[model samples]
Target: MARPFRRYSAGARWYDVLSGERWVYRAGRVAGIGLMDLQAGDVVLDLGCGTGLNFPLLRRAVGEAGHIVGVDRSADMLAVARARARREGWSNVTFVEADAAELDVDGLRARIGAATGRATADAVLTTYALSVMRDGAAEAWRRAVALVRPGGILAVVDMQPPTGRWRILAPLARLACALGGADIHARPWRLVARDAAPGSVREAAVRGGHIVAAVGRSPGEVAPTARS
Candidate 1:
């Protein structure tokens, strides 16, 4: 199936309003970033970074010395992201148009190296987009992690059906995901958690579990959790 760029194309202009940013999705990014614990001067990679909604929070965390490289397959989305950079005066942000599933990792490294003199990102993040990957979320997650420095942070913020009393909201959640072409069943965050170190991984369920955030480190010092 073709990617869902069409859902975002003409509608890209009103996505913040139409996508339920306030009442639903924003909590995921906020909670996810909190767990990532990003540091200033860090070079962060945002995969499937639709319209750069995460830019402001990321900018605050990275500070003036840091840079953000946002990669998205949708040109319409990137156009809005570029405008956001200009409007917000965020010269530190750069947008690269590419598919997350079939990423050109080395080319990206070279481009980033040329632009910011950093070949690898200090952190890799994806919010609400990995599940849409055609090559598979696990492969996309692996590729994203490979772009990060070994000890760098890896974070994923994606959607799932709400739980408990929030289960009442399941229909609405499913509707929203369906409209956006996301897989409500695709718990892509598990890929990150699977590779994360024992003590370094933290998970959160926000919007009453409609959004799930998993923050962890790339394969490194933290010991792997032993299987039973």
Candidate 2:
């Protein structure tokens, strides 16, 4: 557990290059965000948002009026994320450094309110970050879900062992997951299926099925004017 944090802190600068974003993991995030069906001016909460890799797509989905709150435990990683936002000239994003498992819900809500004029967001997303949370993923997930408005979107993208002919790449997949301190078997996407509004689930498997993306809506009526 501690080892992963150390890696994130020390290796964040090289993460986008070394984390196989182009060849593998990026597909999952792309698919997941697409399934989220975000709208312009929607506020999105990104849990465990390392280095803000999801910022560009989220920004596109939410547009200039929308706000993105990126939460991560690593200050170093958040620094990288901050740099990315600055480099991209994204004024609508905010970075929060806090452990997901022990997140202060009220504090986060207040923070969101301060930024977006609303205490909750229109969506919450976690991509390839939950398995690394290990046993804390559930608690982190609960807190994340709490930060979204009713009928808001939820997206989870995480890793798993490769299936079908892609099984030949199992060793490489394991190595990547191992190096990142992720439990490839974690299947964190199940959280979406378990908690999302009934019949709202949408799923996709990419990167030889080693990456799984799931999107669903929280229960209740989606506020017509839920956007910031």
Candidate 3:
């Protein structure tokens, strides 16, 4: 299926607005920070890093010697990220334009190797992006997993179905997303949770029970992996 997020290049400004007002985005950033467990010289990947909202956070965690790559499908979004990087003068960061589902893992490793002489990531993060993938959420998860070297981590934070009887609230959330020019219905949070890989799932609620943040690891330290 054609994903709604692929249309996001045109809606970059609208997304920025939604992210600013949404508590989910805030919680996701916090959760991503905790899950990343960054250290000096660590290499990190921020998949679907729209407008580099979390770049500053990642930059702080990684420090001067660390490296961060922010990947997004939208050139428009990447433009914003680039502008931010330049404005902030963050020399440790690089932004790339690419689809998450189709990202070339080896090519990415090669680039990182050239930059840092390594083929592994200390952390990989995807915030509010996986749930909207056109490929099934599982495929997205698998692709994300493939990016990490053994024992690395993948962390994802996005809007999810409300826990318990709050299911009726989804419509209101959808309406709010629509007002911001986003297609919330295109990303089904509950479906992503249901399809998540076992043995590595950790989840939490945000926005007074309106959104969720989930983290999955590749059977190792808290560094972070996944799709929806």
Residue 80 C-alpha lDDT in model 3: 85
- Provide TM-scores for the models: 0.93, 0.97, 0.79
The alpha-carbon root-mean-square deviation between model 3 and the true structure, to one decimal in Å, is 4.6
Which has the greatest lDDT?
A: 2
Query: Residue 44 in candidate 1 has what lDDT?
Result: 88
Model 1 lDDT, full chain set: 0.83
What is the TM-score (0 to 1) of candidate 2?
0.97
lDDT of 2 by residue, 3-62 (tens): 877876788989999999988888888999998989999999999999999999999998
Error of 3 at 118 (Å): 0.6
Which prediction has more favorable lDDT, 1 or 2? 2
Worst 10 residues of 1 by lDDT: 219-228
What local lDDT score does residue 58 receive in model 1, on the 0 to 100 scale?
95
lDDT of each: 0.83, 0.91, 0.67
**Model 3 lDDT per residue over 1-228, tens place:** 254664666667666675554444666688657755666677888877888888888888878888888888788888888888999998888777877777787887777777776766666777767656645455655665665665565676666445557777777766655443444544434433443446666666766455566655555433232211
